[model samples]
Target chain A: MGDIQAIAKQFTDFYYSTFDSNRSALQAVYRPTSMLTWEGSPILGATDITEKLVSLPFEKVQHKVTTFDAQPSSPTIASILVSVTGLLLVDDSPNPLQFSQIFHLIPDAGSYYVYNDVFRLNYG
Target chain B: MGDIQAIAKQFTDFYYSTFDSNRSALQAVYRPTSMLTWEGSPILGATDITEKLVSLPFEKVQHKVTTFDAQPSSPTIASILVSVTGLLLVDDSPNPLQFSQIFHLIPDAGSYYVYNDVFRLNYG
Candidate 1:
């Protein structure tokens, strides 16, 4: 089995860094067969999902990971669950959003690709 | 706003009861448009997802929820994030699995239905 904890931390760092700086680079992390659930809506394929990410209505965002857990799904795949608390500056107003996201990372060409992703914001 | 904590507890009770007894009874909690991501694979539509649940390899399983958090997504919809540790009797062997699941619940009539559901087991 793979060292899931190490992968989780690495993924968190790489993912959020790309998200904050150059979301377009995320294209390399997802494939054509990938799936994303943003909040409750399902967006299929890598192109559509990346577009959605870049178009998020936030001027600036920062994510703080609270919990990072992982499990190996297959010999070459790992599943990770992450809980995050973040601040988003939208329309010059800063708001906090607590969310949990899941990622199914599949190994290919010595790197990992996001095969499945689900993100939901917690609001009361 | 609705009492999210109360609803989370109530949902836990109702969901596991039906899961332990009559898995078919889950029809009332999902609609034809419902979508489910089991582990990593996405199963669309309620009928297909229900079949997948009933056909799980375990003869008997139990879920013990450790954390239950809920946030209202819209006036009539709520988003819940739950972390569960559970045991499953598969192939006459008992094994424990830690998992995190997210549910997007939409209210219809007087009750709520799962609009989108994602479940992934944490393994290392």
Candidate 2:
């Protein structure tokens, strides 16, 4: 069994750090079948997701995770579900916006790839 | 291929309606392996989940879905991912709170069970 807490912490740290510094490189964690629902808009495939992330209008952004939980899913499958609630700072904005993100990870070789991702800003 | 949009809409409607009307009945959709992260607290199994939900302090609550998206995941394994952003009213509070939820559903005996669920209130 995978240590879900440790995995959640490590993955969230790496994911946000990469997202803050180099959004394009974040594509390394996603596979060709990966799908992302960005604020209710669907973006499929690794290439499209990467493009969508890279094309975000904000020049600078930071994610501060307030809470997160992860669970090992499907007894026969090596998969994990992670849910994160955080505050996002865009363009050095003083007021951070609340955000929610869910990521489904599946083992590939010795590592993992994101199979599904969903992101939304809480306060419109 | 499953109709993700239609499924999400139907599921959300049923879920919230059941949640508001009869919290205990919601257990019919969850199994022993199911896990829920409620406001950062972990609750496992249908029985425990129902107990926790029923024990909530609020007597009345309403959910207004602002936006939702869903996707079919893992070609080999049939599963669906649904993410929702909504406003929640608790105890007839005039101020509605922002909320986020993600549910992973798996097929069993022609219907689906909640395998993993995550919920959080956006504001502190």
Candidate 3:
């Protein structure tokens, strides 16, 4: 549990930092078989999902994680759920959007990667 | 979209109110087919999940939703994802526990119900 906690914290820090600055760097965190759900629409493959991330309308974004929790799904898998309230500066919308995100991380080669991810904005 | 948003808000209001006061009232929101994942463990069926909820260590709880997002999964199904940061006053702890919860709501008759729910505390 201690190891899991440390890894979850480190991965979350790295993940969101890259998301805000260098989204392309996230390639190392996802593989070809990774699955992503944006809002409720499903997008498959790491390449496609990263492309969508880069194409998002927000030019400047900052994620403030309010709550972070991790649980071991199996001997080798850990699912980390994070609740975040973030600021997203978009074109049409001047107000920063708040959202929540969850990621299921899997271990490989002494590191962790995202296997399943779901993200949604906190609005109607 | 408008209808879905209204129902999601109403359901959330009612659900948490019952959760804080009369947990037994939540029985009407979940069916036998309902599924719940608490922390990392899975509990099947409505009766079992309600039992677990009622038996939780916390004596008083309150959920303050920071973000509420809903998406239509199908013509007849809607998935609502909520990000919450709330306080839980337990017996052994002086400070309230903060947590986040996500609920996947499905439509039945003219109302919505929790089909799949996942909850976890925001701590290591």
Q: What is the C-alpha RMSD of each candidate to the true structure, in Å?
A: 12.8, 1.5, 8.6
Q: What does candidate 2's lDDT look like per residue over B1-117, in tens digits?
A: 347677767888999999988999999989998999898788999999999999999999888998787888668766788888899889968899888898888888888889988
DockQ for all candidate structures vs. native:
0.05, 0.70, 0.08
- What fraction of the correct interface contacts does each predicted structure contain? 0.00, 0.71, 0.00
Tens digits of per-residue lDDT for model 1, B1-124 = 2476577668767887778777777777778777676765767677898898988876666666644545443322244433323333334455556555766565567777776676755443
Winning candidate number (TM-score):
2
So what's the TM-score on candidate 1? 0.51
Tell me, by DockQ, which candidate is best: 2
What residue pairs clash in candidate 2, if any at all?
none
- Which 10 successive residues of model 1 chain B have the least lDDT summed? B81-90
TM for every model, in the order presented, reads 0.51, 0.95, 0.55
Q: Which ranges in model 3 have alpha carbons more than 4 Å from their true place?
A: A75-94, B1-52, B55-124
Question: Candidate 2: where are CA atoms >4 Å away?
Answer: none
- Kindly give the stretch of ten consecutive residues in candidate 3 chain A with the minimal lDDT sum: A74-83
Q: Model 1, range A58-91, lDDT digits (tens) per residue? A: 7677666655545443322344434333333334
Kindly report which residue pairs in candidate 3 clash with one another.
none
Off by over 4 Å in 1: A75-92, B1-15, B18-124
Q: Supply candidate 3's per-residue lDDT for A109.
A: 82
Q: Write the per-residue lDDT of candidate 3 for residues A1-124, one digit (tens) a residue.
A: 5776687788889988898788878888888767677866677778998898898876777666755655443322344433333444454565766555776576678677776676866552
What local distance difference test score does each model get?
A: 0.63, 0.87, 0.66
